[model samples]
Target: MYSLNKIIESTGELVSAKVFGKEQNRIFQDNFNSIWEKQRDSKLNIAVIGEFSSGKSTLINTLIHRNLLKTGFMVTTAAPAYLFNGREDYLYICAALADRKGYFIKIWEDGGKTVVEAYKETGPGLYKTLSKDGRSWIEYNEHLQFPEKLEDILAYMTTVEDAVKKMEKIEIFLPRNSLPEKMVIIDTPGVNPGKKDSSEHEMRTRKILEDIADTVLILFPADSVYTQTFEDFLNKNAARFMKHAVLMITMMDRVQEGEREEITEFAREKIKNKFHLKDPFLLSCSAGRAGKDEYWRSKFQKAEEQLMDNLRKKRERILAERTAGLLDNLLQEMNKTVDLKMEEITQKESRLREASVPNLRRTLDESYKEREWKIRAVKKQFKKSLSDDKEAMKVQAVAKVREELAKRKKRLDITKYVQNEKGLNAAVTESSQGMIGRAEYYCDLAGKKTLELKKELDEILIKYYGTIGAEAENEVQGRHAGSDVSVINSLIGNAITDVQKQENKNANSRDKWAAGIGIGVGLIVGGPLLAVGGLFLGIVGGDSLFVESSRTKVLNSFSAALPEIADKIEALLIENVNSAVTEQSNRLAAYKDQLEKRYQSVYDQIVGNIESQKAAVMKEKSEKEEIKEEIRRLKMNLEQWKRSR
Candidate 1:
């Protein structure tokens, strides 16, 4: 009866206590975030992806029956563009300005038929201008006179050399007649080597395919054979892709009239053999040719219908899979924690038997002496472990920061950010600020770990105290056990409250922890594709544009500055963590004294306490089994639904 969001939140809290491997943790966060976003935004995203010269833009243009997207025989779209409809036609742009300064410009049609009649408005300053250099973001927009202007702006925005600086993605809002209310059609940059060669572009394209694409149309020019890039893309993502994929054999008009049918069959059969798609959509277009629109629509009608049907089913399947994946992760962590506790309990029991009382009367006083050396050793080890953890965390923070900067170097046009004197300072300052932010995130994570360590130490003390009480129970029970029971009961109650408080603290801080985890995560499907950091956009002006040669110099400067930035961040994190660690250590040290005082009163009741603890653990384990059974039922139901569909 639990809601998915409630379960997700609980799972994040439960599993986040332990550090999974870096890669596993990143995957979990990305998947978790993806599912979270999916539940929040239930839009069907159909991504059009392919090599350059594959007629992807033409397909979109034909679908909408508007030449809104610029197309040609070469690479036309420079960046990924999104097309969807809004209540009114509007343009929202994040413009890249000098020194990474950008503007969020909005141009809207105010009850006008033409683009020229649309008015531009900054309106109540819904956006901010970045000038301080640290983490600069830009946005810009302006009205257009005609629909044709959309093509012009899109062309300019997508070109690599002339592309707007830090213009990450473009969103076009049109009338309901032009777009489906629940659908978003994405036009991605070509991934072919001879076309868009940038690794960043390739990464972005792959990321869309892997993470966002509800349905993918892999386009190919009809006259040419499939390129290696397309082939490799299929090879890598065949399992998931085959479910919602349709190979589009485009530009069929180029095929000789007598050979068109043969070519279509050949392409279809080739796709079947290599990629497993049996019926490739055969499409050809002559933009200005008479009745071409009719021909294009007629050719695509069946395929379009099938794609829509497949997309709906696929979305449902994805939701189920994502939810199950999260549960699987949570279950793993729970099992690990339980197994560890059980092992510790067994060890304590064994130690108690080995050191059993020779004489019951004398053993009561000596029980406290038995655990003092063990407790002291544990306290010492805990301090050393904290120090080592601090060092490891510092190293991880620095390395993560460096990796992100390196990724940015590949994703962002660094030269553009440093083209002018102001820009150079701004880029450097932003880079430095980014480094500092990364350091702070890890330092906070270490502080949380310190809190967890304190909780753990408390548990160890309680367990060890229970062992001492078990040994002395026979000797002290008649006189001491019944009267002083409240003392040990109070300590145990406090320990449980501390654990509950820690869990609440972790849940409250989940957002920050999630953001920190995102710092180390990159898009999983592709290499550095999307520039997630500090996006800038706007009309290119004020000396922000750069030549190709300047990129090397700007990147070199960033590379040189990175280590220095990382060093400062590392030192800062270490200082912050050390301070937190010192405070936690003092608190834990005081706990030792509290434990000794409380235990002296309950010397005879330790055996009963141990029995109670074991009973509670068994109850918890049984509840976990029920939860596991419920999850199994959910999975079976999901699978049944998928099969029935």
Candidate 2:
């Protein structure tokens, strides 16, 4: 199961659902479920696709001799078939992904029972290319060749040539068995054969081949120079499976020595000079019954052995790449989270230092200074006005006394005159006394106001500069606190934990991820349903181009697999993101509340101080007015004596 080359396919398939939104995921899942209908032994899935006489089944029979499929030099098995697998008294069923036409084998033991199973054929009821042969059933791609058994191959080919075809394909259904199956070899219809059925079968084969065949086993019959079919197939689509393809030249024994040597040399030259291939063996062998001339068996075994070893290397390489990618993504995400936290803290600290507590207090203090300056200026102006008014009143008092004296002098005979003058003077004197008193009161009020202003200003300065909230805030320079500092802080702590936590998470968005899984009815069952999706899977069986090289195969597998890993990873990330946001928003709200309280407290203090200063100035002015009234009477009496003179 683990050696599944399809693991590459499966991984790609599983993760793709997470990639193209839920829509793509549904499509992929739908396809997989629709197709992956069979169970098989834990056998290697060998998809044999080629021309009608490309010896695809012959190769399979060669591999599984004990269960050799009857081959008689023409097309024999018409439907896709499986190679039975057994190990340790356990039988593994070889089948296709319940969805697609390609064959694979897997093994399973349920309660110590071993059996192989394909979709139970309910009837001979046919749907387009689909057919049922006894208990196991599947649609047959006609291009898939059974031509190694000559008579059957000719019968089928003749039907294909005749064009009036009834059977979509001649299908052979193997009996059902429990999977954990061994290699299920898929034989595909030959492409571009002269017969009409050949075209029909070829098209179906091409669809599957282009779409889902993970690895292509291209068989080139030995002793024959590369044909246009081979050239065209290799040249046109070599890139698709450039990472993992197997090129096999069968029937090497047929070639004479000189021809054999030339062919061998031709193969080597074709690999290096034309195809520019390396490392991958260009094998020559025969897929016919293992007899005196069965050279291909040895080559097949060698190829199988090499492939098995290469499979491990490939798996390890894939694991390494994926693991590295996972680690890299984790590192990136961790760095981003940490950077965000630090940035938040830095901005807050900048605001705290450059725009918060200190600036707020500075603004308040500057306002206070301006207010104090304005008050002092106003008070000085008032003081000068009071002083000037006092002097004017004194001058008026002297002038009135002189005017009264002149009146008394002009009316000599003193007693009546002086008494009259005194009466007049007394009346004038009463009016003058009120004005003088007002001036003196204004002077005293201004002086007392000045004193209170100085005192209150001192108190306000002290208060603004004081207070624990302000002090506590000023101390936090965005650095860790010393002594009783919170040695373990949440934000910083989370970063450390994230760094230490190396987890391979599947998806963060549980809901969305789950949605992805349930999106398509096809993938819900998990198999290849590429037929429904119109995938060109049969291209591997295109009549002439059956032997694509190895490098192409590996690349094709990689291309199919990697994106799935990324998708699943991203899904998990998005899920986590939602949770993080929810949690962080709650905590942030609490902090905001605290900030609001601090702002309000400071705001109230500034407003209250301004109001208090204004009230004090008004009250001081009122009290000073009272002192001026008493001073007025003394000035009025002096003025009266001058007037009597």
Candidate 3:
């Protein structure tokens, strides 16, 4: 009802995903496949093994309620034989073809899937008809054989060639509802027999013991306590291969009735402790001598029931243990990854803490102040130089203007053009346009001078910060000794280098107009020229407009506005320089803070991911340990129960 088979299958899949390494994963996957194949509507293979002349065949014959196998006067069951319950009689034999190897053609419902040419007649060569359920039958012939009676089966198995057994294995199917549904009783060739093919028999027996025996039945004779050879065989195999084995002490009738209990106790104790057999069977197959008896029949039946019960319990135990074993390996593999990652994270955190410089905020403040002082000092020196240049430019502009005006006033013959008010107005407008052009040219020169001075200041700031950035890198490497702060160093270092190489095409570059310095004196003085024609028209119409007064108005505009325009231009240059200088200082000041924030963010992300993964692994490991412990306790309880019984 528990469907443990399903659980076991699913667990294998789960372990496959969790286990690491290609080979390791593949091994577990194969183990799961094997477990499923052996458990899924599959037969329990009970291999009957004993010395020659031991009552193994007789015991089996009596148990199945038919003389289904040869008992006396045979060459010790020359080949291995498998007995199963079938609706009709069937037999299969695999014979040695060449080089100590054997091959048999398997004829199944699927129409001869395998054909081995090692034998003379291969493939479905003997079968005449397949049943409605696809069960087939074959005839006795050269390469294929099907014997109907048990005597014929015995005669076929005893056939030999070149001192080696011709037959490899035999399958005898009997119609018996009393046989366990999913069970196959394999009657193997007796070990340590004095026969020519004894080595082959031993080899086959050992292979079955190692590979496929779910339950091994070790038969001994009650007439003799234990032969040295049989004891040695049990020593080598019982504890190693027979986790679900039973020690059957046959020939009990040969011993005296009074000493039966002593012999039984002696054999049971010897087997239970030495061979790890919890229960050693004591029964006699001597009833086969006078034909099978009801008493021996009942005894073998009872023993068969006990063996089936043990098989059931053994399967449950083995499944639980196998499941636990795989889960244990999976847990171990996962723990390796978990522990390694956790160690890396812990070491990183430790390194970070050890390398962390205390009073980081104070350190940042000090570094900021150092760069701030350099910035302010450069600005002060550059500011003074800029002011001096502006004053000199203003003096040159004033001197050039005054000299030009003196020469223009002296050259102008105002009397000639005075009679024609239009000519006089035109002359005055032309002279005003010339003066405005000179003022704009001077303002343009002043703008260039301001850029050159600012460029020089910026270069100084760039050099200072470059030095600061280099020093910061050295400090970071020294202080955070083991911790990786490469990202932080790169960001700050790159910021400084970028500002140094940043193209300042707007600074002192020709064809690059300074948008900050507006039209200067041109917009103000040029506006009066557009109105000069209106003034000329008014005067020519004799509308009380004096030509000389108009001349005075135009000349006064240039002379009076020159000083005011110079001051405004100087103020605009000062404002622009201050802005550039302040921005540079602020950027340098924030770099330290930005680097700290970035480092903290990366550190937090790494720690968070590591902790999350570690927690999950730890939780899973804890749960697996609990399951393992419970299974351990269950096995312990089972052993205690067996001992008590």
Candidate 4:
């Protein structure tokens, strides 16, 4: 039987033995090092996501057996909280600054005293603190000597609008002896909070699920299981994460004893029928009464045991499978490299025996011309495809903006904005912000489309030119043609970066639009109404008519602006898509020249070295046979190791 570490060690030894060329060896080493690090320190990240007032915080508190997290009806958990097992309690709070930096404050108990420290993120994962005058940052790690308690730090993680606006996230360390060692629980913000910023919250939580989470727990309050909002959320986003999801019904005590089983079955059937999640992992727990009530404690214990059991059984198997897959890929790549080298040697030997230098040069030149013509055709097709996609995306962007705005208009409470100028301002701000959010959503979609285009273009290029050392025609290629292929890949990568850059720039412009439109609408509607004796009407007890007139004017103005706002968003999307397409087209226009240069270089080398190559063909033929044998042995070993798992 072969162990994982042993397999990794063997692969590393082979990669380090100079079996591959210099560039191949470097790439393999980097890949191996990354997988090695993952194998060394892999942890399961379980993200808990739900709507507001869904008992997420209470469930986490129950899991950790601590009443540390604040739980109530006011959206207590404003920022994501990462809970980890530790020997003692510690809290780290990160606040976002106006300059797009982070201010981190770490609080923990040391020597029976509460220690507090502050730092700022100067780079990714690099923290530093300011000097005495706050003019420069320095690498100082001493405690700030502030007598701050755990409760004081927890306030920063609350839903106070000011605090929530500035907060990035919070990290909590708990002394949970029963928790699995490699398990981290992330309590994310409600995906559908009852606030104006629900879209932002949903996007944030969705990002966590897509990028960081290994498993997910979607919580529903037992008494109100599967509400319309819950169903809507699952419909829009559940398929992406359902493979690793657990449907948890919290606050089970709120339901009657006899109805709990029926409710559970009903909820399970609903999810199964709608989301196609066969036999989803569903659990019921009363987190609010976790420790105080015996019945609830027993229920909580069963749920906890089931969750931990699943994690324990799945984590090691997942890691092993991933490691095996990476190792297999590495071996396959190495085999390809060796095979290409052997093929090059064999082709050179045959050409030396059969053809004169002049004949070979003429054959190579003809092949180069044919390949260049085909490449030009592919480039032309790629540009046309990109242009068509850009136009289609523009139309799609306009429709999406209109759809989002229409939904906002339908959901607006006209009466709420009729009271005063402040109310009207809130309405305008909400509408504009929603517009910005929808534009951002479209930008994200466009970014993904750009990547898909790049991938398709890459596949087309590789199909025509072949991969790495394997060119379409054998007569005009070199062993290091992979370097030129990599240049093409780099150009595609730059196109992706350009799309993201444009997306960010448009986001900033949308922010400006949101601010300016909100203020402009407020003044446009509120000024004339007040100036035309509406205030006097209120003083004379005719306020109802004045309020109605104000509401009508505000609604009319907003309705008129909707098309203008949507048009602005559509223009931004078109600009971003065009920029991405143009950048890729410009980069790809150089592909023909690059390939030509590579072909010329290889042609010159072959023509100049024909006599030397003919002299060494016999010796190189024997070496190629030895290399083939070595590759066969490595492939056999890789298969055996894979089977050993």
Candidate 5:
């Protein structure tokens, strides 16, 4: 079997051959590089996510056999905490200084030597600081020591309100035996923060799960099992999470002994039926009693073993599968390009044998012009349809936002906002931030709709001028028989077989790709919501005096501002939707242009080859033969690689 390194190297060679367009090759190279880096690092990131008080922290504490994370009835985790295995027990406090930047304050000790260093952020996860002379770099600080004050510092940085606000994340390093080597456990803030409107917390957690996590541990308290909020979260991210997630029923000790089996069985049924997971990996344990209770200890051991097994086995499988899928797609597309080029050459040769140079040139020009007109018409209709979609989407989005705000209004604590102007601003800010998830949903919807429209346009073009190998094969076979038809048919057969194999190997991979696209759309659309909070702050800041007069006055002021707030949200949603739609339209146009250029290049090459047939017939034929040979070689290599695994 070919290793991932060998596969990646082969892919790089093919990409360098210019099988794809410039932009496409660049994208493939970036993805391949990322895969290579991840494979080289060989680290598994397991993110634990849940609702407030869902035993997420307790589970990590149990695994590490340390009471490091703070736990309470309220929302305790303020930022994501990364736990890693190390030689010494220490931690780094990452304080957020600005967007995508932070200061890392490291505290550690070895023997009698203590190290406390502060590094200013210079790049993403990269840091540097000024030297004592203020000209060079050095790593040292005199603020604190390790072990003695580590717990205090961690608690303050991770849980305390004021300290938490300044913190980006907490990185805890423990003894080598504390965790599996090359494994990092990330504890994220609860997605459902009970009564607290902490949209930032949810967004941060969602980002981690979607982008960073290799495997996810979703915790559900045994006492409560699956709540509607949890179900909703799963529904939204089901494609990304279900394949990589392990459902854990934590705090099992809280449930009655007689009902434990029943509850576990019930949860399993829900996973299989509601979530459509046929055989989900699940564990029930009481992290709080794992150290002291024998039965709970056994359960915890099982959970730990399961995690270790996934770390050892699942990571390599996922990487291999992804790499194979990528290579297969690249090779198939390359083969298709070769087939199209061959078909063009054959068509031009036939025309050259029958017509004079001037007549052949005229015929090619007319064909090009007719196809170009069809493409233009398709693009025009596509743009108009997207514009219509933007308007309709805006109306629906506004209605949804209004309904959500109305629900929040009934539950609003008027007295809380009436306390001060800051409180009122915070309330408005939270309300606006709360719409981010909804905005992302709308963006994802628009993205899918745009893709569907683009697909329709592509189909229309395929109907008018068939560039796809199968369609071209039928046309060519109708005109010429024997060897040419055989070659084209074989190429199409192999391409079809490869696609079928990919589909059979895993349908989930395509779902993952779609989910990734949704994440990109969400980031673009959700960004405006962050500023929506500040936008509303300006509108409601003037009403602070009226808000402070009485709870009734505060409610009245907020109610009056609702229409304006709704209008603002509608405008932002429309703007965001428009931006997303325009981006997709531009991409479609680029794709169409790329196709046109590829075919045009082939036509020009055919024209030149025919014009110089007396002088260059043998040379052009030899070059065409080499292309066919290369296509055959690539197809064989891809098939062999797939079978070897």
Candidate 6:
């Protein structure tokens, strides 16, 4: 470790050290926790959704027992909701994050500000504050006036940009269930006049709901059955939501014996097959009061959970496999240029020895300025997409009044009703006014945003081309002292110099060979004559001395050393490869690291958000039991009231 690192570690309690330690702890946790959650978050896009009053809330209630959905309580239940466990899996409230095939669903308006408003409204963070007096007021107040309060909320519902912010600021409504399980539950406006009265919020809700709902659980009251409106909604928006729809037949308890099975079969034959769907599940349920006949409810709940779990796993595996493939392909490219790579690194190192390239550094610094700004801007947009969209605003305004009206036998609450009616009309009229104009506006904005991005892209193209051209110029004019051929030729020149050494060695060996042969010839030819002469003169000859000296010497003594001469060219070729390899390796690594780091944040953010969502869903799961308990209490209270009556 560096001295700084060691110091940080040794005295982590020191003020600066503590600060850095805390910061590093966060960084490391953020990085590792993000990656660790990736595989977990890669699960399927499980969207648990339904039309108003269909057991969407119940299913959520059953699956994850958090009673986040307000029924006969909250200002709305038609607002889409989501839940999931934090370990893995994710849900994007339609109004917020509508990402299709890894592409952002861009706003066709003023920076999607309004749409972003809808997103934030849908899933307003975990209701976490405490002791809010506003909480009781938001739900109801028998002491004051119920209809008036309804009217007040309804008037503001259509154009409330800061509803969520206002709701958060209030000190009264602490979340009923703070730790919710993480499965995205999208409760939407039921089909018909219930929503049409105040449909702008509904439409905005729908636009978002349609975009995010991969799987829609279309609910039908078993007693009433599927109406024309229901079928029309499904058929018209088949493109919007079909692959992930489960037709739920609710209120099995309301029907007689065998009706559940019969209705399910009828739906399969009439609806499922008509849509060409295979084994699309049709669940029979009651929100909280499906008594005695618990079998169907249990099965329904199980199927939803299984489907969600399975999808989550599937999505994760797919992304991982695909990302891995991408990495593999990139790694393969790095393996190329094995020889030339080393030379580049060597040159950079040589340059480092002399000085830092301030001009090159400054140019990169300037180039990144725009990129940094763009990165921040894109991140802000992304954050907006991830935030909440007050779901209740969409269908709540309509559903509340409709339900309240259904229970009433008398005339309307005229004073408040008239105000609500005006608000509803104003909402519809405002939206309708933009019908032609908004269509045109969307088209124009799409084109304008496209062009603006295209211009940026064009700049990128220019930069890319300019970079390529500059690199090409550098390559064309580039020089390498090592590759100068003169340097290498000099080394090769020594090979010729070594030739003299070999030649001298060869000459000595040749002379010895020649002398040996001559002596052998003389000895053989004059053997008889020499024997007679030697006896007479005692062998006192100078020729004998020369022969004796030559006999001791050997030819071909340099043969072993000559073997090394053949390997010189091969060694030089290897050295050339080594010289190029380092630079090329460094370049490849730098590019890879840059790309990985560039994408790392996005990946980490995605994973963190996804895992967080999963935890929320799991919380929902656990809370389902709690909801059941509450229902049990409610049911008991109902029975006791009946007994009293």
- Top candidate when judged by TM-score against the true structure: 5
How many residue pairs clash in model 5?
0
Worst 10 residues of 6 by lDDT: 100-109
Q: RMSD per prediction, one decimal? A: 40.0, 49.5, 20.6, 37.8, 40.9, 43.7
User: How high is the CA lDDT of each candidate model?
Assistant: 0.52, 0.41, 0.52, 0.56, 0.58, 0.38
Q: Higher-lDDT candidate among 5 and 6?
A: 5
Candidate 6 lDDT by residue in tens digits, 113-195: 22111212223342222213322443332122112232233223212333422221111111233223233444454434364
Measured with C-alpha atoms, the lDDT of residue 76 in candidate 2 is 34
Q: Best lDDT goes to which candidate?
A: 5
Worst 10 residues of 1 by lDDT: 534-543
Q: How would you order the candidates by TM-score, starting with the best? A: 5, 1, 3, 4, 2, 6
The residue-by-residue lDDT of candidate 2 on 277-384, one tens digit each, is: 665455566656354344545656676666545443332332323323332332343345445545655554444334234454454445445534432343344435
Q: Which runs of model 4 end up more than 4 angstroms from their true locations?
A: 1-37, 87-103, 109-115, 120-149, 176-178, 231-240, 320-645
Q: What is the lDDT of residue 304 in candidate 1?
A: 58
What TM-score would each prediction reach against the true structure?
A: 0.45, 0.33, 0.44, 0.43, 0.48, 0.30
Worst 10 residues of 4 by lDDT: 473-482
Q: Which digits, one per residue and each the tens of the lDDT, describe model 1 over residues 472-550?
A: 1111111111232233234323433343344334333543444333433434423343213211111121113322223
Question: Compared with the true structure, what per-residue lDDT tens digits does model 4 show for residues 401-515?
Answer: 3343333321123333222334323333333343334333343433343343334433432443334122222121211212222332333234333433443454345445444
Kindly state the number of residue pairs that clash in model 4. Answer: 0
Off by over 4 Å in 1: 1-30, 89-102, 107-150, 193-196, 237-239, 256-297, 309-314, 324-628, 643-645
- Per-residue CA lDDT of candidate 3, range 1-645, in tens? 224555565565575553356887787677666666666645777888889878878878776766656677355775666777765443333333232233432321123232222233334564222222111222322333534433554445543432234454556565655467777888877777775767777887777776677667778877876777877876776455454566677776777889877887887777677666666554434535424466655665676677767665665555555555555555565567557766876776676566454665675666566556555454465455555555555455445434443443311232222223343223323333323333333333333333343333333323322221212221111111112123323332333233223212212121122211223223344555534543443334321223344334333443444445445444544454455456545545555565445445655665687678668767766765654454445445445544544
Off by over 4 Å in 6: 1-48, 72-78, 86-182, 193-198, 238-240, 290-645
TM-score of structure candidate 3: 0.44
| lDDT (Cα, tens digit) per residue for candidate 5, span 1-645 | 555567566656655665467887777677677667778888888888888899998888888877778776864776788888876544333334222355455655446444445567687766685332211112123222223455555666666555556555677877766777688899988877745546767887888866677777889899999888788887885445575477889888998899999999998898778878878888888889889989889888988898677666656655665565566666566566556656766776776445332443344344444443432343344344444444443344344434433443321233332333443333443444434334444445444544544444445335433442111111111111111223323332343334334333333343344445545554566665544543344334323422233334334444544445444544554455445545544544554455455545655665686567534544545654564465456556655755665
Residue-level error in angstroms, candidate 3, position 614: 16
Per-residue lDDT, model 2, residue 409, is 23
